[model samples]
Target: MTTAETTGGTTAGVLAARQRSAELEELIRKDPGRFRVLTGDRPTGRLHLGHYFGTLHNRVRLQELGVETFLIIADYQVLTDRDVAERLDEYVEDLVLDYLAAGIDPERTTIFAHSAVPALNQLLLPFLSLVSVAELGRNPTVKDEIAQSRQSAVSGLMFTYPAHQAADILFCKANLVPVGQDQLPHLELTRTIARRFNDRYGNGAAPVFPEPDALLSAAPLLLGTDGAKMSKSRGNAVSLAATADETARLIRGAKTDPERHITYDPAARPEVSSLVLLAALCLGRDPRDVAADIGDKGAAALKATVTEAVNEHLAPIRDRRARYAQDLGYVRRILRDGNEIANEVAQATLDDVRAAMKTLY
Candidate 1:
């Protein structure tokens, strides 16, 4: 279904996605080699707890399942709505460190930067032609991004975000993409582009690309300490690389309601409930159960509980991060190796694209 037609995030939509996810999981469990997964993040800043729970953990799980995984750093995408290129290199390395610390093995998953793969970017030219300006404008994910960026006039890159993302997925011929509900529209656009490209250019030959399916993550959206969606730009996120003291300080300052009695009412008291939710996610307990355990304990006890749970859960990851941080050369080499592999894959895909389109002279 097209993004315009489907009611994204509705009960029905989520149910459908869950069903598909179940089927995909079974397929991967039985024969992981049958799928290739493409997933990534824009290196806007250091990844936070939201990244860890929402997507990073899943990437590691898929890799351990023996699936071929391609993780793009999306460095070029940083210019889409904001210009934080000054710290681009630092942010990219931080992402690599976070990935490694979070258990994304470079030996199993190919981790590369978008700017480092030329043929991948080259595919954007033909991809742009297959999509429409209106469709791109109507994309819910693009609309949300523009709203969040608060740009008065959207840049060309921002306008073409979906098509560029399509290129990112299709370049490696990846058959699966890990995503959250909000990202479903963007993935649908990628599917549309792949279908159109094959219909127009395949000319009865074997299709050059797979219409990738979403391996939907079951993790709930993690709220920042400030009770809003976790975001690095907002200064509310707890980075995976944050020191234990820093994490404690941040959670201690989190915005909780003045009410001494705490309960899990996300609608009524989002701040208090967010803290409760964080503790629950870390504790592997239901939010209601966690809330009940902290019954009438007030915000101080809640924050303390959350702080301890977060730190304890992250202790091992932090140790690994510290070790990886000391070896900058090794980290850079991992990126270099990933970029080499990506370049090779992208070239082969581009060659097929050219052949399918009869553009080979």
Candidate 2:
């Protein structure tokens, strides 16, 4: 089977398994009052389409559900691979701007930079001691990162990233983690650590960490204009903050097939199919219906149609972002308030954790 077939089959199998798993029963048993969700982005670059569809859009939905959400700017995770940490401050600031511009309400949600929270880092040390080095090596995310980087040399911090991630979730006592299918292992590891810590230290007291479960999203995986993965490094990603002219230029230059007529056969014509997907997402129409409406239109006409649809879709978001970008002080104030809220919650969790371990006086 081809890569696409393999991916499709795996997704189907996972869906079938999920339908049978006692997920609903477990959810009821946990009964987390209101979902305390923890999800975050690494401060490596500006948010792009993959980030938007894969997580950010769902985050907006979760927030609307009245779930208590905490968005972390994973600044320290940048050190896992990138050597230079000098410009990290600026990178984190830009990330905060991106979140605000994308409609993540500072008033309703807590947002904080990872490095700014000392308690979260402190939790990491004990969390690391709880898990073994060999176990960390077995984490699927760690393996993927190593393969992606193709690095002969790996850092100890990089190797233990899952533990740090566990710290991020456990430090907030988050009970719901919105994640894609690929991140199930991370959630499992977090649950394992929580169970181990509670068993080891509970001593008739409440558990220090709440085991978080994946709140799976049904969002589609958006592909880049180049028909590859939607990523910044590939130069195919359209930025959330892209200007109107830049957006148009990228759409026009996007790769399409040699056929004079446009159709939405993803398997046969991936490039045209990709454009159709983009147009459907932008216009909130079905891809098949959009393809049919464009019937005999050539690729040029299709490109024009897709461009108009996208620009219309992004115009409001762009305007909102511009307004927020103009007031640097307002953004800073939002982050400051958000940081305070997150820090209070994180410190409370850490204090509980320390007390459980008999380290707190």
Candidate 3:
């Protein structure tokens, strides 16, 4: 195909995704109970603003809308690249704390870790059989993960990451997953596996799984303080757990352009524009308007603007976080209850799978 054809096709795909997402939002608003969402994070470390606005905030919104939500900690997946077992316990609890602080209600959502649910992990075995080695490798997300990890070779879990995610989604029979454009490929793989599984085993009856659709986030990617993608390892992220003073200090040191005149041209001034964008997200305004508000202000003034907005926005969440931190036992109970619920649901799904395949004793 010609370059024009490829570009046109890509543009069409993006437009279609955006339309579907809008439709899904409408459906969720009308009858949120009809949708089940399976989305999560790897407990590698603290949750940052990128995570809060990019996905966490959406999770809370969905739960409040009465959607059946399942949040997996993805504790086992953390070992796919590195060994952080020493702090794994701490990290898991920290994630729960952040979730609560960010308004994730345990009463409304199911928050669990797979390591505590054997049946959920057991789904991985059958899921692996439904996918091919080449298909797994073709997943762009897995390829990027392998490349980024810089490992001499990919581990089995790393190679089968997509299938693992499929199990995570399918076990709960989730019909909607919140994701970014980059993560569309992962959801596609999950949809493919769900279709293939039903084709192979459904025997002209009810399908065993629902192919989940992508609820693409409307939020733009929040960049790090250094003008790069916000990441925990890069040390550019503003952690939700950070104190008010710490948040101010981090934003104060954020990178910005040398130009005295502030603007929100991301293509040309990524660093400055990113700070403006962050402040804009907190203030619920357009980045360009935020820039216009800071016209002629130097980077110092821009940084100050961001610092104040971010801290003011996060004050309530941090207050909630500190109060929750005082009782780790309550956090632990939430995880425990979520695990019990997950095990029940996963066992029921696994039984259905066995029955569909006629493998049940």
**lDDT-based ranking, best first?**
1, 3, 2
Clashing pairs in 2: none
lDDT of each: 0.89, 0.78, 0.87
Best by lDDT: 1
Across 22-139, the per-residue lDDT of candidate 1 in tens digits comes to: 8889999999999999999999889999888888888999999999999999999988887546689999999999999999999999999999999999999899999889998998
lDDT of 2 by residue, 1-361 (tens): 1111222125663464355233632553455346688999887677876677677877776676567889999988987865556577776777777787777998778988888888888888888888888888888788888777634677777888999999999888988777767776677678788888999999978787777766666667667888787786688878878987988898888888788767788889888888888888888899899888887878888888888988887787778878888888887788788778878888898889878888877
Error of 1 at 202 (Å): 1.1
- Residue pairs that clash (backbone atoms under 3 angstroms), model 1: none
Q: Give the TM-score of candidate 1.
A: 0.95
TM-score for all models, in order of appearance: 0.95, 0.89, 0.95
Residues 68-127 of candidate 3 have per-residue lDDT tens digits of: 999999999887776345588999999999999999999989999969888888878888
Runs of candidate 3 with Cα error greater than 4 angstroms are 1-12
As a TM-score, model 3 comes out at 0.95
| lDDT at 36, model 3 | 94
Better of 1 and 2 by lDDT: 1
Please report, as a residue range, the 10-residue window in candidate 1 with the lowest summed lDDT. Answer: 1-10
